[model samples]
Target: MAKLDLKTADVPKTREDARPPDGSAPIPIHSRARFSGWFGYVVLVLFAIISLGPIWIAVKTALSDSGTLFTSASSLLPQHPTLFNFERVIGLVNPADPRLQQTSFGKVDFYLALKNSVAFTLLAVVPQIAFSAMAAYAFARLRFYGRRVIFFLFLAATMIPSVVLFIPNFILIKDLGWLNTYQGMAAPYALMTPFAVFFLRQMFLSTPRELEESALIDGACYFTIFFRIVLPVHRSALATLSMLAAMNAWNDFFWPFLVGRDRSVQVMAVAINSFRAQQAGGTPDWSGLMACTVLGIIPVAVLLIFFGRKVVESLQYTGFR
Candidate 1:
């Protein structure tokens, strides 16, 4: 008699025979086209109205002139729609007289601030994700001394309020002579964040180890495996992290204001503040302020519109893991 390799055995299963070991009936498949109920639809409709009502009001006000916006706050539609506010806030077009209220308010150069925002976001996010993936890979796969202790310290750091580190970061940046520079704005954030490292570590751990072992047998190094194999498999996590990093950098006010006070280097939030500071008299450029707010909102809004579904999938996958 020949000995058999049970490890390599293939077992065939039948649908009717796929019952639970306790012999409970198999779950029945139901049509996904069934209605979720009128109550569910009513709740969703109410949620949509609650979410979109404020945004519609903002858009309406942004399109109207200051005279109309202040007087007709409750108007469902703009009585008069114009790009005067947008052109004013952007500082690209000037009214006939530079002394005019709108033109004076317009001189803030929001376009430059927007450019700086894009550059800083890219510079910070790219290296941040790269470093995070490397750190996460080490934590999830490599066997090293004091790994648990070091990881615990990283987790502990997240518990401390970020506000607590502001003074220390400001002092360190000042000591390094990095104030008012783009490098100063981007450098501090261009490292692995604890949350990012933890999230990616969870993702890396869930990936199959056999793929890495196969690469090792073919004389591939860790870098090759990481770059060619691991990252490609986790693009969902990468996309999700990239979106999160972009959101943080895009909406950031305090840190950017602290380190980048220069006119040429100011981000969107600081630029908007400077624009508002000039409203010393007159009707107040509510339209221009609203337009700037709208401008600040567009990039992230578009990002969510295009990549929202993928990011949601990544979240679900992470939660399931």
Candidate 2:
């Protein structure tokens, strides 16, 4: 035993004192991280400019007076913006030339075409989504004879190009006497999109089966589980499917053009093509064409803006995740 020296003895301090003064906190110095952050922002800005620059030019072109459009000094900022082009494009102008075709613009039925496109989209999209959803649910959850084989067949069918079926589809429509009608335009295109079913089926399958099992234990039928649980949980998938279906139906040109022999049933794409052809009689009205193109893009833009996130999330949930 050592003798106690009480007056000059050292004592152990608390554990807090064991830590360094600047303990795990790191101080960010002026370095590569800051530079990288600034660089990333700059790159983003440049990318945005590159992406949207043409769209801005289109807007400027659409707003400029039709006469001044061909002039060289039409900068990104229009020297003079006028609604005349929009008016002419929308058929608000009544031309004094009767011998010329009666058009909303000087030569195009832009409004009618837009209307037809909207109608076709509306008529086709709802049934497509509903039918696809039901089919997907059955394939995903229901155990039936030949279920796997049938699904395999559907998957195989998706590999076949729509263009290959065009002739037979056309003949069927013609036989049904649905030529140049809205029903004919929408019907053949709307039924049982294999890709849509496949997409939704994957989503439905990814959902935990425990929920469906619980529902079944409670005496809830398959339809009840689908409607109450599956649909609600997979709303994102539905939105994505609906948006894609609508886009396909709306932008469809070749099929509609071939089937819609009459002007009354012609979609916007066909109408736009017809407008381009008619306007280019001797000289192309690039301004009017640009205006029509802008108008045509608006609906799709709106749909994307509203439903794009859902579509992306749904796609992720369905497969990518």
Candidate 3:
């Protein structure tokens, strides 16, 4: 063997020795990392602006006077930035005021519509979530004959266009004499949706079976295990599903419009549309319209804001993962 020089065999190279032959200083690792971080933040900021632009415009329009909107259509900030539109939309404005007469103000039973929306959302979401969770548990945990086949069939229902089912559902609701009623409004959505079952089943499937086995050893029944063990452990999943179902129920228009058009049961969405249609001057009440839009959006926005992290965590740990 050749004589080995141990003195400098594995000595680390100096910065200068590691430099390229062109004599340019190599970029520091920290500098590159910082640049990448900044680039990512810039991209996120740009996307945020793009996503929020229309919402901001709607807010701006909602706050502006109707005439000012026409006069300064390009303005980013609302002219005079008044709450008159919001007050008018929410029925806080005096009905006899000259200002109220000029626009579609105080003509809408917005509070009633808001109440109906809340009621419909509750009716739709509570039963749907409860039934869907039970179905998901059965699909995920119970081993019965044809379970897989039934689940696959449920999955198949998702592929069917929702519009294709509407006529049949409408007929069913009408035949049940549920027209213009909260029950009719909720009929299509009050029970388990295929998607809800599928979503909860995935989470249930991912849950460790050891807990259930332990519960079984302690003489716990299926319902006991499901309610005490599984449901308690998946609170985040349940909350996420509830928020999604609530948002969907809150925003639903077409079904409610078709089956619940009476003023007593009109939802916020249909009410907003009717408000727009009832304007006197043949001109759209852009300010009132946008104000109604914002009001209708507020509850959903608040739900997302408060429970948004739970939603993300549920998706990350269960379905998406």
Candidate with top TM-score is 3
Give candidate 2's total backbone clashes.
1
| Tens-digit per-residue lDDT, 1-321, candidate 3 | 111222232322355554668989853434444455556667779999999999999989998987787777998999988998889777787778699766544367779999999999999999999999999999999999999999999999988887789899999999999999999999778888887898899989998899899989999999999899888898878887887777678778888999999899999989888888886577777888898888877875786698777665654433210
TM-score of each: 0.81, 0.79, 0.83
Clashing pairs in 3: none
User: In model 3, which runs have C-alpha deviations exceeding 4 angstroms?
Assistant: 1-44, 103-106, 311-321
lDDT of each: 0.77, 0.76, 0.82
Which wins on lDDT, candidate 2 or candidate 3?
A: 3
Which candidate wins on lDDT? 3
- True-structure lDDT of candidate 1: 0.77
| Off by more than 4 A, model 1 | 1-40, 95-106, 282-284, 314-321
lDDT (10s digit) by residue, model 2, range 159-238: 77778888999999999999988889898757777878988898899888898899999999989998999999999768
Q: Which segments of candidate 2 are over 4 A away from where they belong?
A: 1-43, 72-74, 95-105, 304-308, 311-321
Q: Rank the candidates by TM-score, best first.
A: 3, 1, 2
Candidate number that wins on TM-score, 2 or 3 = 3
Clashes of each: 0, 1, 0
